[model samples]
Target chain A: DVKVTQSSRYLVKRTGEKVFLECVQDMDHENMFWYRQDPGLGLRLIYFSYDVKMKEKGDIPEGYSVSREKKERFSLILESASTNQTSMYLCASSSVPSYNSPLHFGNGTRLTVT
Target chain B: QKEVEQDPGPLSVPEGAIVSLNCTYSNSAFQYFMWYRQYSRKGPELLMYTYSSGNKEDGRFTAQVDKSSKYISLFIRDSQPSDSATYLCASFTSGTYKYIFGTGTRLKVLA
Candidate 1:
């Protein structure tokens, strides 16, 4: 069984404050993804990293950034958090054989920006 | 129209009843189908996956995909309260990182 650990379960931040959400996967998967799950919008991708020091923007990438200094760890950064940025963030990882493999996801980090 | 569509159902059913959840996709390029279960305040956990138009069963859950109709389904047998959660379906084409996910359907198995 693969374990994906998130740094926080609940986060509260003030508007204009910088915030960071961290995630780590035990399995040596090559691909890591960050997504925000909203009420009606469903799960929208934020950023993804395919390799160390590499990153790509997803559908909703505004007001967000990512860092993947290591293969096992992926971090999402908010330069200036806003109330609208408050949502549940999810991290997932998959290996190169993504065809048959499903993305193993972490529990999640729920953020509340005021 | 959305690429993938799922009913935002708060389907309520009694325990030990069979539960059916489904989704439909508009893109014919989608070749892989996946089902995920998400509890409140949690990330989605993959429940099942199918390569194409076929039925795959695992324990109490079965996933079916019909490429001709662009439809996918997940059936849960003898539902338990533990099965109460949101079910989401996803589809993606081969050799691509882009995956389209349905809006998700919420289910409650009453005791």
Candidate 2:
């Protein structure tokens, strides 16, 4: 079984503070993604990494960035956290882009920016 | 228009009842369709997947896709309390890594 682990389950930060959400996958998958889930908005991709040091912005990448220094780890960074950035963040990984290979996701981190 | 559209339903059903969930897409290029189930405070997990236009069944779950109308459906038979969760429909174009997701429908199966 594949294991995707997010570093934190709950987080609280003050406004204007920088926040970091970390994720690690044990399967050495080549693709990693970060998404935020909100009521009525569903899950929106924030950023994705295809390979080490290679990152691509998804639909809603503003106020956030990503790091992929190693194949097994991907991190999402909020330059300046705001109340609007509070959300349930999820991390997912997939071996490759194929019909049979769906993404395996982590439990998620619910961040509260106050 | 949104690429994928789904009613964010808080549909309530009694145990052993049949539940149906649906999604519609505006993109004709999407050939891969998927349904994910998300428990409260947890990440979404893949529940069903269908390729092109067809029906695929796994145990009590069935997934159907209609390419002509760009619609997808997921049916659950003999639903249980454990089946209470948010259901999200997703789609992707063949050969692409990105997927578009619909707003989830929250289902509550009462015992």
Find the number of clashing residue pairs for candidate 1. 0
Docking class of 2: medium
Error of 1 at B23 (Å): 0.1
DockQ score, prediction 2: 0.78
Q: TM-score chain B for all models.
A: 0.99, 0.98
User: Which lDDT value does model 2 have at B20?
Assistant: 96
- Rate residue A92 of model 1 by lDDT: 92
Pairs of colliding residues, candidate 1? none
Which structure among the candidates has the greatest TM-score? 1
Q: Tens digits of per-residue lDDT for model 1 on B4-96? A: 999999999999999999999999988889999999988889999899899999999999999999889999999999999999999988767
Candidate 2 per-residue C-alpha lDDT over B1-111 given as tens digits, one digit per residue, 9 for 90 to 100: 999999998999999999999999999999899999999999888888888999999999999999999999999999999999999999988667788999999999999
